[model samples]
Target: MKTVLFDYGNVVSLPQAPEDVARLASYVTGAEPGFEDRYWEVRLDFDRGSLDPAAYWSHVYGRPMDGAGLDEVVALDVASWSRPNEETVAIVDELAKVGVPMALLSNMPVCVAEGIDTLPFMRPIGPRFYSGRMGLVKPEAEIFHETVAWLGVAPGDLVFVDDRLENVAAAERAGLAAVHFRDAAALREDLKTLLG
Candidate 1:
């Protein structure tokens, strides 16, 4: 493989915790109960760029928020999704040291994408594609195809790593070799074998 494409959530960043989700639900449940369900119900639309940040938050809150309230909710929402998986990041650093070509592919909203861009770990990884920016999400053949085209590499020449089985399966269907990421140790082994 000439390049390695990585999924951000769970692969590089930590997965969302149940407690975190509950906390977010609590924040906006003033007018609406079941805020958690509402938050997730429209997440795909939010991540796919179909809903703006304000609209997405409004859906969660079940009411329109003023400028200050919107900014607060946006900041909290981004923080909830921004936790890093240190072990995975270390693996990425090792790959960088060895001169491996890598790029990021993440299902994220524009607000979260902007926040991730400012992260120290993400700064080194360029040409990252966010679903919100690409207007696509994972487990879809088109996102993989579009990423391959953007990287100027053939699908067969690229290996994708994602924590989700469905996303890994989709990458294989899209003609890219894929790794179902479980831990950094396994990822190290996979990369060694693939790059050998």
Candidate 2:
């Protein structure tokens, strides 16, 4: 059976809002500027479970964080990534209504993934694969291969969607049918061609 695998960040969920990012930055002492850049710079390690929440925040902040301070920062970080892309979510709802098999794969840290899991839209997707939990990040062949194995599907039978071109290329390299997600309308058209 064919499985539609969706990436959570920027594909299922909206991009992190600038305001939210700024709010997160406000909590870090002596690091207000270029916070977003720093956030992304150390994100892969966090997503791959190489660094725990305290370590990840400390890396981003360039200093150690107290337990309560780390908790607040983690909460703010999770809240920043919690918004859903309504257009894409609508498509997921439509697919679910038609009984299409769907799954979610995201290079998200455990803290953020826990927040995302509580969102209502996430309920429709089966078999979510979080990088923090899997100990592997996307654009890596092993992650894609592992997902295919877990799903018990041939690589060709899994339709993977990700906003990052590198991830899409990696999925293709793993022999899965991959779509470079641009926008909701374009993605709808692509899915129609692929799923129909």
Candidate 3:
């Protein structure tokens, strides 16, 4: 049986709200022009569990952070990415109703993963893999192999959906079928063709 593996950010959840991102930046004193750039610069390391919350925030802030400050920033950061994409979520629901095997793979930090796991939509997806917990991130073949192994399925039996083309390409290289997720509508059509 084929298992549909979905990417969490952008695919499952909507893009992080701009205002919420701004709130996270506010925690950085004298935030500069390239705050977003800085955030992404070390984000993979943060997502890969190489850097813990305090260290990650400190690097993004370009200075050391206090405990209270870190707490607020972490909460705000998690909240920023917490909004659900109702359309995609509906697709997940439909798949679940039919007993389609589904799983989630996300390059998310542990803190954010914890927050995301609490959402009602996430419950139907089993054996969710987070880069932070696995010490690996997507667009890397190893993570794909590891996930395939964990699922006890051949790589070709998994249909991986990701918004990022690079990750899609990597999944293809890893021998899993891949879909470049543009939106829920496109994804639904793709799944019909692939799953049929």
Candidate 4:
């Protein structure tokens, strides 16, 4: 069976708002200095599972977090990225109705992943592969290989959809067909062509 791999952040869920990040930065004790720059600086390691939540937050806040502080940061962090793109979600529903195998693969931290798990739209996912869980992130060849292996499908039998061109390119390099998702409308057309 052919399978479609979906990217979580921008493809299915709404992209994080800049204001949201700014709000979270305001709550961080030490984020006054280059808050946005700092967030992205350490984000890769955090998403790759090499840095645990506490360490990742500390790196962002410039101090160790107390239990309550940890909870707050984790909540805010997850909330910032949890908004759903209703249109793309509808597409997921359409695909599921027809039994098109679907799975999720995204670069995310454990806390965020756990929070998103409770969302209604996340229920149809199969064989989810998060960077936090897989220790692999998109645009990396290994992740594509691992995903294909886990799905028990050949690369040609899978289609990967992601918002980032680099990620789409990487999947292509790894031998999987990919769509650079610009919007839900484009995605619907792309999937039709691929699945047809």
Best prediction by lDDT: 3
Cα lDDT tens digits, model 2, 85-117, are 999999999999898999988998888889889
Work out the TM-score per prediction. Answer: 0.92, 0.97, 0.97, 0.95
lDDT of 2: 0.91
Cα lDDT tens digits for candidate 4, 13-128: 99789888888889965587788777889898999999998898888888887699889889988988889999999999999999998998899988889998888898877778
Give one digit per residue, the lDDT tens place, for model 1 in 1-196.
Answer: 4688888988888888877776677776574467767888999899999999889888778788669888877877777778888998898888888888899888889988998888888755768999999999987889999999989988888888999999999999999989999998899899888878
Separate clash counts for every candidate: 0, 0, 0, 0
Better of 1 and 2 by lDDT: 2
How would you encode candidate 3's per-residue C-alpha lDDT over 15-85 as one tens digit per residue? 98888888777777687567898899999999999999989888888899768888888888888888899
CA lDDT of every candidate = 0.85, 0.91, 0.91, 0.88
Where does model 4 exceed 4 Å of error?
none
By lDDT rank, best first, the candidates go 3, 2, 4, 1
lDDT of 4 at 89: 91
Residue-pair clashes, model 2: 0
- Residue clash pairs of candidate 1: none
Error of 4 at 48 (Å): 0.9
